[model samples]
Target chain A: MNAPPITTASAESPALPNRFDLTAAIKDGLKTALIMLGLSIPILAYKTDQSGGDLWLSPRWGLVAILCALVFGLRILLHAFMATKAAREATPSPHQATEFVHAEPNAFQKTSRFAIPFFLGVALAFPVIIYFIQGGLNESRYWVDLGILILTYVMLGWGLNIVVGLAGLLDLGYVAFYAVGAYSYALLSTTFGLSFWICLPLAGILAGFWGMILGFPVLRLRGDYLAIVTLAFGEIIRLVLINWTDLTNGGAGISSIPRATFFGLPFTSGEGGFAQTFGLEFNGMHRIIFLYYLILALALLTNFVTMRLRKLPVGRAWEALREDEIACRSLGINTTNVKLTAFAIGAMFGGFAGSFFAVRQGFVSPESFNFLESAIILAIVVLGGMGSQIGVAIAAIVLVGGPEILRNLTFLQAVFGSGFDPNEYRLLLFGAGMVAMMVWRPRGLISERSPTVILKERKAISGSLVKEGHG
Target chain B: MRWIQDPLLDVQHLTMRFGGLVAINDLSFKVGRGDITALIGPNGAGKTTVFNCITGFYKPTEGLIAMRKPDGSNLLLERLPGNSINWKAKVARTFQNIRLFSGMTLLENLLVAQHNPLMLSSGYTFLGILGLGGYRTAEKEAIEKAKFWLEKTRLIDRADDPAGDLPYGDQRRLEIARAMCTDPLLLCLDEPAAGLNPRESLELNNLLLSIRKDHGTSLLLIEHDMSVVMEISDHVVVLDYGTKIADGTPSEVKSDPRVIAAYLGVDDEEVEQVEAEIGV
Candidate 1:
């Protein structure tokens, strides 16, 4: 398909065309469809055979798919030729507009003045909208599972955003807190036969305690040294989980673990099961839906608390510390207390999410909380935009939820033949998307909001007029 | 001799060392209430070092920097950490290389200087995040204070502009405005006129004079420009090799043979020329 016109000049440039047609969009769409169809047929045929179905549909449809693919491919080549010819025929124009970049926003252009209300409205209405639409209420177990997954990552993203985003502290081993929370809940609940509710706070407290423990050694360290220490701390937590067999279940994992009950009612078909006791029909989806709402609530609470903390003096202190440590110190702000509070609070949230994870899975394993988990969570925070609550939620949805949505594309299997699985290429696509996002928006989806101070006359100022450092 | 009131800041035997080199050695000076004292020296005379030591940037090996507050409470600045020095002593300062929060607007930079006051108004409550009631009031007050300084510094028109984007002269004035927003009792300035043109320097002189006239805030300055020193300073102290060589009024220090020797790089020949130049 033909590429879009570069349109390199600014909006005011006289060289710009009056209107550029998006006619190539249709051809591009057709090309993509044909390519996918050409690749999916054999794979669908193989799957059909494995499921004991007709064999002829695969080969017959494959030929037709290839033929259409060839036609689209030739069209793409022709379009490219036409685009180059058109470009060469056009005369060069030179009326470029001057672009002005501002370092800071004006009082009138303050981001917080608008963003706080916008995000709060979204957070408040999201559950109501989901309920009205009956989202996850009648869906298969996987839909509810997907909801839980999104919530889990959302909480983790918020937690990690505090450490890495708000504080400008790169934590490569944040999963250590997750592990500490999960294992604490698992060990305590199982050993004492306690319920999930009671153990949850205990687990979070334990994780927060460990965060302080970790914070002490890295107090004087910054940047790379702090990252390495946190990474080692995570490894230490994982190693202990693996080596300490008596306390934990070792590599075997705590299987046949008790699933979290709904207000003490199990989902089983027993006398005390939720379905039987409530006179409702038994469906595994009920349990999944319950877990989904449970996690969604927790995630919302995490976001709410984080948002509140950020507006406080401590929150501003954290931001100031992030911007310039020397300045923060000169202002009489205690850097040590600020750093410790951030670590503890961030870890506490992680622990809450981890405890919820253990209850949701009904099993705890060291393998689940690995370096990759830490990396993925960190990526979510970075990609979402640091120091932004809503950005983390949006990023989690795209990064974690995107792969699951891709799994439902059965049409891709038909085009790729028997050997190709779309899941295998999900990470490759994810990596490419990340690269594209970085190039397109280096400051992440939402840039830092400028602080508003009341001017004598309260005159509005445009953000572009201000000059502030981006980083 | 008019003793005036007690010195707002008293520095005794202030010594700072960087390994083998002594940046400030046994330096003693007293800045009287509402006095604009100039610490003048040749380059590398450790004028800025003394400022740093007094501001708690560098801990002196042996010294007592007692800042007498309006309430007559003494704050031993040397014993406090760098962060606590600002709050306890109410001593504000400006850097030779202006360190305004570049990404913040001119008004926001000023308000940030009042961070402690705003925190107190909020009672450090989480409800402050919602910006309800009291927090809103405090925020409004902060803005008013910021605007007051902006007007004072003649930056009201560009209050919403980012501080870093301002013209060089405006940035220097904004730095002073930011420091003033802290409501400090004493202001320490390090080479505020280093890069300013003649007109800008005159404006700065006017601003500093107005500050002393209106706020009654004592000024401690380290400057190389003899014009600035002789123009505004009530008293001048000359240093050579981290030791004080002369301390008196600008005219008295200007006439001191020792001060002349330190500036002219001569023991005898240049001294006569220095006296002639000062009309002494």
Candidate 2:
């Protein structure tokens, strides 16, 4: 095999006898440059500019040419590097092809026993710690808000983790349930004058109902087909919200919905309000603190329920289904009920988070419940180990909080010209971050599974042992 | 002792066809209660198709698969769903390829076999999630049952290991252990000794013998290994081209002219001389 390849190479390229193929390198570079120019012309050559309330297209030919040149040069360099490396290791060992991509568990993975509790402790004290560090509630309000957002996403990630992670349903329209919950709360509270407490459970139930409705049609679907159907389901819900003028207010959004009161006491400055009843200085920080705690409690509830459920028979059925649907069926597991239960339970939690979002913002909008939210939540679940509760929390913090934290990096402006705002390149950095994370850890950050049921002693099972589902 | 009079499973003129391809054609056989029956066939002779029909994995196009329950009631297996055969009819089966829940612990795999009982005791997960006393008792009982089978399969020490991590022979035994944990009336094994060495085959023979003698579980095995077939089977049914050519005791099947011809790919006249020369 090795001899034939060498003979063929020598016969094809008699002119380049030394094997330093400069002409080939130039050909590859020119081809890449042309492809780059064709792709980048429409996207980079023209930019949308809004000046003094007027929108117009501005040409960026020089910038486009510079970017194309950079792409060409980079492609050439990469090809040359790869070619030289291949030449250096000409006789590849057979074992190299069969060897596993990852070795045994690393030091960090082994210490997950300590890492989980440490992360929990930090999460529990985050708002208080931020308050003390900022020296005042007013200064720490933004940090508290960001914390709430991250925690909300953590809760959502954990919620979707049941259906997609544990059951292996590949739900791309999970945000449809979130939207259902938001609309359920918004409509019930505004039309019927219901309290946030009354609307919370109602929203969850309605969202879960929608989840089953979507789940029923796609029960027979698997893998990419399931994903596509789910994605369509999400889009259908968003479109319905946008077009339904009578109920959802048609993208104008519902405002002044009502803030979440302290169980019946409103967070108002007037008499009989929470601030007055408690006899504290009527500051807005009280409501912020209450909302923060409310979401923290909700997130913890999601974690606790998932933890307890993992030990149950149904939970094992879900994991078994994820491992091998055919095997699960052969085991006499009622796969229909198992799948429906997973979707309903996962949707219920997403609904709870959605209602919380409405209460936190004091407004409801279709804009907040879009495909992007579903993508981010799904990303968090995958980046976190699929069924891991703590991994989801850490991933939410790093992926969501990381981008928000980048907004505070003023030093980046000095390094990359005065107009270089870090927030402007947030999505670019996000895509790059995702690529790097996948390259570094293909399985996930916390891929080890703590067996739901164990023998005399419980042990963490390696992710390599866990099947991520063929369906 | 009462079941000894009637067959545990009866298939009458069972036929399965996929589009225009007749996988099983006019097949009829019976599995005796508390007996190890071997179904031997050449490659693509539809031995697995017969197993599938009996186990309710495939609903035969034309057949009456009557399974005799403990109460002497007959279950129309072809009409029932695949899981109903496993759960209600108590007909459990292993696959040609090992299909143990690979990601789960060996104990967990066995425990999942007791899902129906545990789920019922737990009030369909309500009491289970609450960690109620009833659910706890049921779970403890399930773990005990799983441990029992794990011990029987000689995998008690590796109960915590993932099922996939076990060696091939151990995995085969674990599949049987998991099926036994389900409290099956009929255990159907497809190619259990396909890849086993001599020692492993001997161990598997002992395990199967113990299961039949100690537990009184009716076993229907589809096997290609002639030594395994000739050694352990009380009744042997030979199949060729999706039809039962011979059915008898081990010694009787070994000397049958059609069985010899089917296995050796010789004509009917040549089969007698071949069997006589081998002194079967």
Candidate 3:
């Protein structure tokens, strides 16, 4: 490799490209094969099983050998591909081929402009589409249930996006606010007999209050310290719900919480029910349809308000704070209050989604509000490409709906074995998917950043240009 | 050098100590209203320490840092809390290392600097989101102010480009443009010409001069560039080892024996010798 390049350079006309070196390529492949052999030996070569006091060894050296050989071949192919790519790049094209006079709209930009409204239209007509396809509300129960689940996660993802995405605050305990909302609706409607509509706002306000309480102490902390304190705050909320038997009923949970009504109309079999008031045939799907629409509306509310706020002075302050705190203070923006407002608003939306969860489930418990749920929601916010609403919605559908779809894949049991469950491997697949996502597209799916407030013509910028890497 | 006796700012016995290493000792100086005051010192001379104290980034261990208005009212700057030094007291500052919101556009940087007034009219974010006319008009006016500054800085064409993507000279100008958007009474710039080429450095001096002439905004800047400091400054305050060694007109301070000795790394007795040897 060194001799060929030197000879070409000394010739004064280095026209020939650096030829691919087969020996070097073989050397690289051998190294990869060695590493794979070492890894596959422990993880794949042998498996042990013990039944009643007897142990059995199952050897799979053949599988390990095949994998190592496959990796070695793939390494050589990759080297050849990369070498050709470099040669092509080194051969300069015409000036017009590379020079860009000005930036034109990219493929991502054009597709994104179409993707948002298209997804929204689908979301709007989702229940009706399901009703027509399943033939009736009675038969489409599973699909509608899946829709509700996806929308709920979508709502939660948007709420967390405000804090972790826009303001650039790493809040690992966002689910605590969700729990606060759920518990607030559960307690208020159950203990006081308040209607769901009345308790909804109260739940959101209470959650916002809790958000401020969490915000005050953590104002001075940033990055990892901020995340740790927030994580602790979430755990404390969960523990309190578990131990305080007087309010939360301890581990037994609160059940038969009041159902979310259709405004003043009930979804009942008797008169004055939603079906009866409309004179439509009595069906259980009315409630499902209403719940589907309810969550869709709530999620849209979160998205719109957040988008609008991004154009406001307060919203600009949030982004500025994310960029640089010292710059924010020097500009006369009160960073303390700015951070607190972010917490309050984000938690308020979380609370709204939480109340919706309580109504949909008719139950509230500490089990529903755990650290894992917070981690999942935060993952969705990041994986959706922070500060991008459409990205979050797409991420929510993939992360949430993907597993739900797997639960319905009964064919997997027959192919693998009768005892095999595909859901068991969901986490493994999810981990692999996230790893692939990070390696290939580190800035989530749609990483284009446009100014929230444009003074002149709007221009698209690369997302990582301003991305806060602390989280 | 033209100046006013009734200083717009008065610093009395300002002492800022970080443990045993006093970053700023019992130092005192005044900035005249509608005048450019240049603070010059060698490395570790606490020029930036004085800036941090005035901007409320640091609290002095002992001192009175006051800002006076022509109406006979004064604000004790060191007594002011965080961000209020800029928000309420109208003392905006730039950094030695550029600190623009690199991800934000040039126009957004200016708009963010006008946050205090915009925050109020937007009803602390609620009314603004409602798309009310009052907030919209205020936002529009704020944009006009931003555009004004952008025009002055000659950066209006690429106003939408991210601040970090700009050339070095443009980034420095954008920082000043951002601070000016606050409509500040006093603008403090740390090394405004540190990284600029000679031509760009001359342009920055003109910008600072125009800001003082047209807006009546006082400026205090720390600069190693003698051309910039000596060209535009009305008053000069020199520091060494956190203590004020010379304070007067730029010409007088430039020739001060103590300042020459401090900068030349010579003892006071050997200052004359060094000055003769260097042919200054």
- How high is the CA lDDT of each candidate model? 0.77, 0.86, 0.89
Q: List the residue pairs that clash in candidate 2.
A: none
- State which candidate has the highest TM-score: 3
lDDT of 3 at A324: 91
Model 3 whole-model lDDT (C-alpha atoms): 0.89
Model 2 residue A46 distance off true place after TM-score fit, in angstroms: 16
Report how far residue A126 has shifted in candidate 2, in Å: 1.8
Q: Give each candidate's interface RMSD in Å.
A: 4.2, 2.7, 2.1
Which digits, one per residue and each the tens of the lDDT, describe model 3 over residues B53-123? Answer: 99999989999988986678899998888689987788989999999998788888999998889888988
The C-alpha local distance difference test score for the whole of candidate 1 amounts to: 0.77
Give stretches of model 2 more than 4 Å off: A1-105, B1-4, B267-280
Clashing pairs in 3: none
Model 1, TM vs. native: 0.78
RMSD of each: 9.1, 5.6, 3.9
- TM-score (2 decimals) of chain A in model 3: 0.88
| Tens digit per residue, CA lDDT, model 2, A242-314 | 8998989989888888889999999899999999998987989889889988998999998998888888888
lDDT of 1 at B106: 80
